[model samples]
Target: MENQQQTWIDLAIAAMDKAYVPYSNFPVGACLVSKSGKVYQGLNIENASFGLTNCAERTAFFKAISEGEQEFQYLVIAGHTPDPISPCGACRQVMVEFCEPTMPVLLVGDEGALKETTVGELLPYSFNGKDL
Candidate 1:
């Protein structure tokens, strides 16, 4: 992995430590880099109502978007799973909404393994604004 990617992965891991996972005990973290070079970190925030729980990827995206950072450069998601963590379907749809098709999406696993992919690759033929 490139130095920058490693740095993002480390940030995601650090963010994971802050996750609030009382129900599933599954913690996840995400780091989003904007086109302007701003970085946003997010951790899973679980709620008593399972349906209200938010994933780390959406948290990061919401944070960046609310802060007026629209164009994203990269995204890194970290988890303690055996393999590199993949985003949930909702998160993938959000990625398709806000991220460029070719934007890099990095997944980091418990052993620090890395899997690099793109927004489009994650959800091929996704429904978007164009489909409306």
Candidate 2:
């Protein structure tokens, strides 16, 4: 699983080419590496409404869940920016609901940078099904 996680992160980095972010021009790619060793990739798609746009993290997570992947244990986000790219609040919420507290979220930059953090550390008070 270790090697597969790295492969998924690289795949997420490669998925950035499919980003359709014209407004912010900040293309982002994400990968949800499932516990079953499946890797799902997502590229940010923008909408004119802006509010209707979906983030790469959620897209990938939803895609995996639709495919019967209910146990995603690792996520990696990559962008062209110099700094590591983290998930947005909405994405973080989705992740909190979709994964366990110990799941790792990896942030990577265009220059092949890396920052690995557990979901528990990144989101202190994440919303879950119990929150409602």
Candidate 3:
């Protein structure tokens, strides 16, 4: 599990380097591996209208879903921040929609800081579209 998560961490950081962040200059990247062995990666995309921006976590998840991946087991998020930054509230909610409740979320920051947690722990009570 450690090795797998570490691999994703490296991939996440690598993806962050490709982020399109010309506004806040804060780059984020995320990578998720489906149970079927497919890998999906994404980088933060900023827009002139900040409200139109999309998070890296959701982008990666959606990209996978678009590719027909509906089940995931691992997620990795990386950024050039001081500490490990977890996913946003919206991303957390979207994650619970497709990933298992206890799916692992690996967060990494600059200087190799790493933390592993679960989606259920991050968002104790999650809801699907119908639940809302």
TM-score of each: 0.97, 0.92, 0.93
Model 2 residue runs over 4 Å out of place are: none
Full candidate order by lDDT, most accurate first: 1, 3, 2
**Tens-digit lDDT track for model 3 on 34-106?**
9998889989999999999999998898899998999998999999878888788999988888877788888
Candidate 3 yields a Cα-based lDDT of 0.88
Tens digits of per-residue lDDT for model 2 on 59-110?
A: 8988998999999778889988777887788888888888888888899986
Error of 1 at 113 (Å): 1.8
Clash-forming residue pairs, model 3: none
lDDT of 2 at 22: 88
Flag regions of model 1 displaced more than 4 Å.
none
TM-score of 2: 0.92
lDDT of 1 by residue, 1-132 (tens): 489888888899999999999999999999999999989999999999999999999999999999999999999999999999989999999999999999999999987688999999999999999998
Task: Per model, state how many residue pairs clash.
Answer: 0, 0, 0
State which candidate has the highest lDDT: 1
lDDT of each candidate versus the true structure: 0.94, 0.87, 0.88
The alpha-carbon RMSD values of the candidates against the true structure, listed in the order shown, are 1.0, 1.4, 1.3
lDDT of 1 at 31: 97
